[model samples]
Target: MASDDEDECGYFYDDEDADEDGVAAFEDDAAPPPERRADYTGFRGGGIGAGIAADRLCGLRIFVCTPNPSSFQIRKGGRCYAGSAAITQESLYTAQKQDLSTVMNLLNIKQHQARALLIHHRWKIDGICDCFDRKGRERMLRDAGIVLQENNSLASGGSRIPVGSAKCNVCFEELPLNSVSTMDCGHCFCNDCWTEHFNTSVKSGKKQIQCMEVKCPAICDEGTVRCLLFGKYPEMAKRFDRFLLESYLEDNDSVKWCPSAPHCGRAIRVGAGERYCEVECPCGFSFCFNCAAQAHSPCPCIIWDKWNAKNTDSENIKWILNNTKSCPKCFKPIEKDGGCNLVRCKCGQYLCYLCGGPTGQEHTWSSIAGHSCNRFKEETAGKSLDTKRQQLQRYTHYCDRFKIHGGSYKVEMEKMGPAVAQRVRLLESDLNLPFAMRDGDWLTRAHRRLLVSRQVLSRSYAFAFYMFGGELRTRPADQATLGVAKNLFEDQQERLEHHVEHLSKVLNAGAPAVHQVENLSKVPVAHVPAMPEAEVVRMKQETVTLAKTVETLCGEMYKCIQDELLPLLVEPMSIAAYRPDGPDKAKELAA
Candidate 1:
């Protein structure tokens, strides 16, 4: 409900001096204008020439930094604003201190009051400040059920105690002053009754316990709640503390826990406007931040969801429809890949593929002798099988390509990745090879590009399938324009697919062999072999060139989708921008 400016202010600015509009006022009259700050550079330098070789080979820049970097910091308006820190049960207090310190410093309020405001506003400093600006200090405090009492002595467990006994409100019994606890709102109640209320609230998962007095809009003091509950209900006290600590994640919109299986116990926090982006968690799981699903882009979440559901059943149906025929003896489906129409099933029944009728064992490739069911079947008036057939064919065309490229990506990642590493080690150890040629990281980079582009190629088919097929097809007037756009998109997709495949092939090509010396008995003699430096150089160049080409094609395909094909749709859809180095790796959180 708060405006963007208010949200930005909350994350970045300290509200020490501010105007009526909630903007922070500069303390100095004459101050230099703020300079543009660089965005978070998570990847840094490679070892000198290796970096240059990588860039030249891939036709893309690669950053290599020493000591590594922390998770990419989310920057806002040229200043770093949001980022996630891993929080353990022991570090919860430390993780929460920064936000608490900011609110306390800006509002000049006590820790408990700051926490109350944060909880009420969902821990959004911007929303709190905006409310403070719009409603003034007193009204904002009142809305969050906080009452700033002047007489500190009247607060619960204060040093001062009443001289006489007091009447307990709930039980209507007179109790000694020390037996009753007074809340911040000056409402007094017997300790036993207070404990019961606090325990019930805590059990019900209520983070903010209100004062028991009717019409009193004050929250119970956390210290009082802890002190009272810790004595009798230590576990409940622990639960209450945990609830308060986790409110930082539960209440804040910008942060989310890594949705990894077995629990990664880490959260990712993005900038205010970055909810729709893809982020990789330190646990090596990359996901769409908005949907928390596997990183699927170039296909909107809605389309991806539908595609997944359809594929689950569609594959089986497709196999049945295209590849199988019912066996005459058992009425069971049997698939014939390529031998003959007269197929024998496990039940020892010979079946005709054309008609699913019983056939004799004596048959040739051309004919099941004397048995024929090739006569044209009459078509029904209302049922057009051709239209249904065409639809299935269309879906198969796209799905086949999608599965092929997707399957290839998995193979390359599993098989080629380690092989490339082994080849790089061999090249580095070869004494005849130049020192500059030893760094074969470019091969790894190219292989990564191949994998990434293949993914794009795979998902693009899904996008095309929905964009140009089915209910989303354009109207008649737009058909010609749609044809043009479709051609352009397909062209890009084809080009990207070709280059990605080429890169895969180049990276998969085995490394040059190094010869090992053989020892023959008595007098020792060593034979040295010359390295195939020229072949190595040529392979390196080819790998780099293919990688660059794949990267470029991927970029072009993404551009066509975003700028050309997507605009044709009535509804808005977006995909994450293509990253040349694969999805950005999340840095580990500092201790």
Candidate 2:
């Protein structure tokens, strides 16, 4: 593991002037000075905004740029991060360049050829190496749609034409050498045909265009295509360039476009096998990289999808159908607010609520006279309805708690976040305060723990909903074994919930109350009253201790899910492991 300033590229900065180019590296572990800390300008412009504060307040380690003091950069570390990074449109080229140069240098291939190989391997350099070693270089290159050397002799010797002209196989016309193009696959076609083919392929959303000849798998040379098409179709050529640029994300397994709306124009790249992890973008959007949904860890992506679908309009309809019966005559949904088995619809139609059968508007508590539907039916239909009711009740039990914690998270993020930040500024500004007390990272870490725990606590309910409620078809055959597992899971969930709420309470206690915040809003930073020294110590100790406890409990809960619960299932399912700092803020890649 590298230190925060070591810059995950396997380099250490012994001093500030490590780079030969004179670009100073950030080496400090502590945050920037109070005057230099980024202003929270609510996620609108490019400067460090609410999104960065959300990350900082939540426990993420952010390094304020020295050159551009106002800029904030998220350092990747902590549990389950796996070295993920953010690649903006401007930096995508840089990110791709690193990999391209690696493959190019290793194999001594051209840039375009290396790119094709990387795209075919989904940008896994290790996978490419493995294939190269096992299958030999030629086979590996051939598999990746590259035919660099083997057929070059064939193209020159087998296709020698009358010095100045060659017949294109596609158009079957003799064209001068300049007017025709020869592909690496030893196939020659008129330049016009190649351009049309390239245009059609680009329009069809194909990033890699192959040779025009049937049964030929060689990828057409990108430079040649660009040279031929740029003169006649500049717009299409640009679109072609974009397609190739965007392919680094679309074709690669380790990267994905950020799911932020209005197009953040950014893509996230993660270490291989880390696709299941949740990540937060610099744009202030946090999502499960695997599913592109709200960060719902501890719940598998499939379970989250199912839970979301279950909460849609269809569930409301199911609730209506369960509680209400359609009127016999009017066919309108009717609910029996209270009374005997007999009920009257607003349409003046009478029916027995139990069996939903029409009857004269009269009935006793035990029986309906005209409808002999008092007897309980033990048929499959009745069993099905009973099962549905049980399922709905079970869902409601988990969903209510999930929603409650989710709501609390939003409130705390919006209200407590700013309040804590303000307190941090106030404490830092007070010069008379003890140097130890001035560092407010403890409070920020504690509040971040609260936010992350709240999220985990909320999503844990969703996991339980699908796991124990039998929403998933896969379950252990032994009912007693499952029962024991459920108990163990719920025990962990209960403990996590308890400490999360406790942490939240402590954070709220440390932060100024709503009215106090309102009053502090109107006061100057220096004028704000400093928290008592004893109180500050107590709060710091309590918050830091509670944060560690919550972090441990969260890790244990995830262990219960991954190790204890998931293995019992016949079908495979996985959730991202817990990160105490919340999702690691993906570091923005630099060119």
Candidate 3:
């Protein structure tokens, strides 16, 4: 802990041991925003300032009116620090060992037994504890296919094995004691049979290989499995080892493999009860820990899934299915223009519009020649077309806005990000300016605000599509309540959108040009131009103010989402809570 005097003096130093609550030091390259503490006040209705709680503040170095602060307080937000850790390939064994150790020490059980318990409980320590409390130790262990022995020798199958000779239950052949092994369940099987069974299980992608004896509920010892297989099949033994190691990620609820393509070979583990939060891996890939999708907050996974599917190929297929009939001869989609049972395809094939079958060119209103169809089918098709058209229109409206903001976000991230960084370098490199005036944290914070706010604005459209749309099965009685909620949501969303654009404009308009030292070689040093001090001050203040405002507006939008809108749904769904710093970065666990 830092002394009070040190904190008051703004004594900043780089410390790898720094925690989420510790003051963060920035670097030249793009990095995850450091964790900060913020206090949440209950949602209050008023102007933007009234709703601006500490919880909504970004994790940037917030310099309100000056670069230096006399004193400050850090308050933790509920969603800011999700206590997640990044597990890389290097640290995978260490992490798995830690979890195994916890269970082993807690229950005084062997490593394999602990592993069985953890895998069965999905690697949730609290769940194991809860089951232990509810079912007691004996029953819980039994249920997880763990049979505890009084001593190591008993558990090792030494007592049950005969000194002379034993028959292998699997092969039904007489085998020497040296050639056979007994499992913890007292089921003895020949090495050949055991190896083949393990080989089959491993080839079939079974992680937990159980005893070969029928009706035996015990998990085979991992060490024994390895010993039996390593001599004949070294690669399969290695694979078996890999499976047990990877089980920490595959079986655990809180941990997930980073969803990066070309596989980052890293998994993230979040704190208990925080699987719903978003996290960033050390590999620079950010994702929602809950759904393993791109870091999309304010948009629930279900809505995002629906939106993605709708945008890609589903809508096009739907439009064809709903509005067009396939030509019977060419099998191409053909639209009906007007007043005809017989429709001509561009492929020179004639088809019945109502029945979508081949027909002669001559046709009456009631029937096409050689193609009689149900007249009532026209009513059903008409009604279906109307419904599909309305759905397509609504989807297009929301999707356009979603894509627009998303496109803007890409531009800002790729283009604006470099511009901001260059300006920061230009400002900080100026030896003529005062140290306090040269700090570019305000600009960085504002730009981050723009990027995050744009994301919120974009995803909110997806949320609105599902929330008030027909995807949710709402009752007629709830219609009035939903209307009021929709209006409120749209109001907040509109406010956020306005400020986000304003911030973007401010950032783009104010992006400083890098004063190149190389260009100065051609010109006299005295002729060099400099930005006025007053303008710099004004730019700082304006950017900071807008960043704070956008931060607050984002909070209110999320508040509206959680408090006003989501509860009205028939089926329960939840979104990851908004974090002003974006997703929490998963700390790399040491090997």
Question: Can you rank all candidates by TM-score, best first?
Answer: 2, 3, 1
**Which is the leading candidate under TM-score?**
2
Instruction: Single out the weakest 10-residue window by summed lDDT for candidate 1.
Output: 36-45
Candidates' TM-scores? 0.63, 0.69, 0.65
The sequence of per-residue lDDT tens digits that candidate 2 reaches over residues 1-591 is: 123112211121111111111111123323334342222111112333323223322332333333333233545345323477899888986677666655554454555678899998998765675576578667788887787632354433444322367788778998986677666666778888998998898888777888998978888766666666676887777787788778888888888888999879889887655778888888989889889998889888998998888777576546644654589899988764321235689989887554567877543322433344322233523455677676565565566567667877887787788788887776676677788678888888888888888888888877887787665666547667777777777767766665675677677777766556767757777565678888888988888998999899899889888888887788788888788888879899885
Q: Give me the runs in candidate 2 sitting further than 4 Å from their true place.
A: 1-82, 150-180, 188-206, 313-390
Q: How many Å off is the CA of 39 in candidate 2?
A: 49
Q: Candidate 1, residues 142-250: lDDT per residue as tens digits?
A: 7787776432324323333333676778877789865776655667788788888899999999888888878776777676677678768978977987788788788
Q: Which ranges of candidate 1 are over 4 A from the true structure?
A: 1-76, 79-98, 105-193, 246-249, 261-272, 314-385, 472-485, 510-531, 559-572, 588-591
Deviation (Å) of 458 in candidate 1: 1.2
TM-score of model 2 (CA atoms): 0.69
Candidate 3: C-alpha lDDT? 0.67
Q: What is the lDDT of residue 68 in candidate 1?
A: 19
- Which prediction has more favorable lDDT, 2 or 3? 2
lDDT per residue as tens, model 3, 1-591? 124223212211111112111112222222223221111101111123221222122231121311111122333233344277889888997687667655554454555678899999999866776676678667788889897543223334344444467788667899887688666565678889999999999988887888897777778767667767876887887798789888998899979998988778789988755767888888889898878899888987877888778768775656544644578887777765421234689988887553566766654322333333321122434454677666665665566567567877887776677667666765776677788898887888888888888889888888887887767776667788888988777777766765676677678656633244324356553454444678778888888988999999999888888777777776666778788878888889897
- How many Å off is the CA of 525 in candidate 2? 3.4
The lDDT ranking, best first, is: 2, 3, 1
